[model samples]
Target: MRVAHLSLGDFRNYRTAELELRAGANLILGPNGQGKTNLVEAIAYFATLRSHRTSSDTPLIRAGAGAAIARMKLEAAGRDVLLELQINREGANRAQVNRNTVRAREVTRWFSAVAFVPEDLTIVRGEPSGRRRFLDDALVSRHPIAAGVLGDYERVVRQRNSLLKSGRGSARTVEATLGIWDDQLVEFGSQIMLARRELVRDLGDPLSAGYRALVDGDHGPALHLSESVVDTLKERGVSRETRAEGSQSNVELADVSRETLAQEFRDALSAVRLKEIDRGVTLLGPHRDDLLLTLNDLPVKGYASHGESWSFALSMKMALATLLREESPAGDPVIILDDVFAELDSGRRGRLMSAVSEFEQVIVTAAVEADVPREWDWNRVQIRAGEILPAGEQTSGTPEPKSPADTDPAPGESLSTKDSEQ
Candidate 1:
């Protein structure tokens, strides 16, 4: 997982652009309101297909443009892969891998990326939906096949919710149709829940180690999956582990298998059927789960100071990157730091840089050159209002006059290491 080249058209702020990239630390620097974030956003969008900044795709397309196109040449595991996406406005988007058309969701299988943005702070204090999304993203990255599993599960949940909301027929008629959806939900949802639980289990040790590196004074970070179905099983009775074939007296997240979770999902849905019908929504599944973050036995969201919260969030992202690096077959996933250095103090900034500097590829964006450490030997790209200057050439359309980036390589130009020197 490294990107060798990238080209963009009508994406975010860029009308037409192309740039060659290296496999080490590549920095994109510019002022605020410029397209620095947009540059990295396109890189990451190839991996997850979801924007960290927004929930919709409309903003991704340039204003007044019918569609946007992004193409990339990637090198992973000793081979080169070309990935392309057509981001349309009215109908479904299209995707191509190595020039062959495939389902849009299949685009995620080709690239693996994890991004650390200022918005990542929301994962700590935000709603459970954000946390669940975080889990699913990691799961898909870890096992690309999970994309299909998650897609089917979400479709089942949506269809089930629709039926619950619009049902006005006889009890038997509604119950018969609901059973079909319930079975599909259990089948797909179990795989999602079990995979998420496994990831959280693996994250506990690494997350603790990462936090200690970022912060001082003996603060231990902990991650726990707050699953709705598991809690419900406990409230109904008591036990540590229960087989799926038998009644679920208790749930053990770490040891639970897909078959066992599917059984519990069926039981949980059965117990909540009346309530679900009344509320007109599906409840008691992975969609309702949350990933709990704790520091020294206390939750970080509402109790920890602002610094502690940021530490917890950073550790989570860093820990996920570490896990992927360990498990990836050929190389580590591309790590993107989108305008993140400005938000940190000096010590944390150094710690963050040291941790990621050794990766196969790391892309950083910042408004201030002083914020990034000078020891990095960084390859710099100067971006201003969607115009990119590689390293040694200067160009027009720069937003700020007499800025630090006024003397850098212009667009469509090849750059050298000497060009990046101060």
Candidate 2:
């Protein structure tokens, strides 16, 4: 899918700005603190229903303003679709598609976008929660039903935690209540586990391949879904043999059936009830699971150098983009690269540009115009003090349109076409 146009009103630093995008690459050049990122963030918000940078929606609204609005016209599967998001601090956020109001979930049905920013390096070097969030977000975008499973799991976790925190109840009563939560938690947690496992399994090969390509075929990265329940149960002598005979099969972590996982979850919660009561929190479930990233079998957190960590992060983003392209019915997801060009060396930057050029559309933000590939057909938008210049007046550079063959090239294909003389 490609965004044909975007309009912003009272959003961040943008007072009122409209942009028409090209099918190939659209470059947003600006210095720090300008509104370049805000423009892309608006498009991404329409795609994912959340901001990639901030968790709270308040900052998305322009200061001194009460509300913010973002409108996008998208072209997907040869059809034109319109998506709009309105956010007001004191009021409910609203969304619409094709001039019709839609439920929050239905808005996500319109488009999918994958973003790669310099901060994404945290996905590899940061805490487990971030990785888990990344997994869930990707799952929700690809399989909308996965959102229901995640929501259910979170609700159970919250209720269980609340009960643990309210120390006014008797032990017997608490245990009974905990039992109910455990059953529901297992039901939803198992679904989440099963969905995550299958997603990782499907993404494994593509992830490794994408990593190799990003690093110039020099290294392979491994993604492991680490689960506390699976590991905890095995420690408690719950043999795979006994578990396999039940409804769900006790296979590998990625292949563990939801029913089997639910059974294991129920058993683990029962065993850990005393410890949980003492700790005042629910400790053992998908909520505590992690997505582990290893480079050549070593954990990337402290072991990998800065450059390797960046590669792993970019690789993961590229893999997500590729996966969305294959799975999304709307078509290829629009790619947003935010201030990442400055983080890569010349070689890696070339590879990343090569990988991104294959997408239907790409919006990149950078401070240096030289960072962009000169050969690709690019539409440049220069931003200064929250103001966007018209395309022709933005840069001395002229528009260079990539041939159809170049614009729609297959993945891993070389983009070494002769530079168009502008």
Candidate 3:
């Protein structure tokens, strides 16, 4: 998919701005805190429905503003589609497709975007939650239904935990109530598990290849889906029986039914009731599951060097990009590189640039132009103190013409001689 245009209103430092993107590579060059990342964040919001930088939406809105609005026109599969998202401080957020109001969840059906930021190194160096989130986001983009399943699982977890914490219900009463949630949880959780398993299975080959290419084949990398449910099911012989079906193995879970998993879940919960009661929280579920990344049979987080961690993180993201291109009907998803070049060596940076060049479009933000490939035919937009000016204008030492006070001109705006004469 290609983003045709983006309009931002009251988003971060951008009071009102519009940008038109080229089909290949678009560069946003700027100093720190100049809202370059904000533009990419707005585009990413269309895909993931959340900001990557901030936990709260309030910070996304301009200071003292009530809400922020992002409008994007996307070209996907030979059709023009419009996506709109409005973030409000108090009320529910609003989403629209083709100017028609739709549920927020429906937005994913139209667009998919993958972002790679410098902080993504955290996936390899930081805590497990970050890696898990990386996997989950990629899965949700590929299978939109997975998002709903995740939401259902989280809801069940909350309700189950609340009941466990109430402390008034008898063991029998709680068991019955817990049984209901366990059934739903296993049903949804099993689907989530299977989806993740399939994703990791498919991604492993590409991830390994990417790692090898990134590091010039000096190291071998492996991606593993570490799951509690899969292990538990295997220990119970369910996995063996399922595998007996040969090519139809995955179908067995659906055929034997969620009821069976639910029964197993109930038994497991019963076995752990005393311990759970003591802890005051639900402990064993998909919510606590993880994705393990190993390089030569060692965890990347504590064991991998800084360069190795960067390679692993970049490989994971590149693998996700490949997956999206394969799965999305909208062609290749737009790539956002947020100051990631600063951390990479010349060879690694060239590899990343080469990998992303096959996509329909790429937008990168960096402090130095040299961070980008010198030969890249990039339409450079220089941002300083939240104002964007074309590279030619900035380099030519000509003052950029003032835009209409209402809306900023799209990227690469030029100053007209007539206006200068006036």
lDDT of each: 0.79, 0.76, 0.74
Clashing pairs in 2: 1-332
Worst 10 residues of 3 by lDDT: 413-422
Per-candidate clashes, comma-separated: 4, 1, 0
Model 2 TM-score, 2 decimals? 0.88
Better model by lDDT: candidate 1 vs candidate 2: 1
lDDT of 3 at 202: 78
**Candidate 2: tens digits of C-alpha lDDT, residues 114-169:** 88887698888888888987888888778876766787888889988999877533
Best prediction by TM-score: 1
Cand. 3 Cα-lDDT: 0.74
Write model 1 residue lDDT over 1-422, tens digit each, in one string. Answer: 79888877778887776666798999988888888888889999988877888888989988888777777788999998877777777667777677566776787888889899998888998888878888988998888888788878889999988998886333454687999998888888888888887898888777887888888555978888887887776666533355343432223466767777788777777777787887778887888889888888898889998888888898999899999999988588999998788888899999988888878999999988899977887888887656788765677654331211223223212222121100
| TM-scores for candidates 1 onward, in order | 0.89, 0.88, 0.86
The alpha-carbon RMSD values of the candidates against the true structure, listed in the order shown, are 7.5, 9.6, 7.5
lDDT (10s digit) by residue, model 3, range 1-422: 88888877788887777677878889999888778889999998777776778767889888877767777888999998887677766666777677667766677778888899987987887777887788778877888767777878889889878987875435654666766766777787777766776787778777887787788884767776655555554555554343453333323433544445555555555556676766657866667777778888898878999999999999988888898898787799889888999899999888888888889999999988887876678877778667767764544343443322234323222112111100
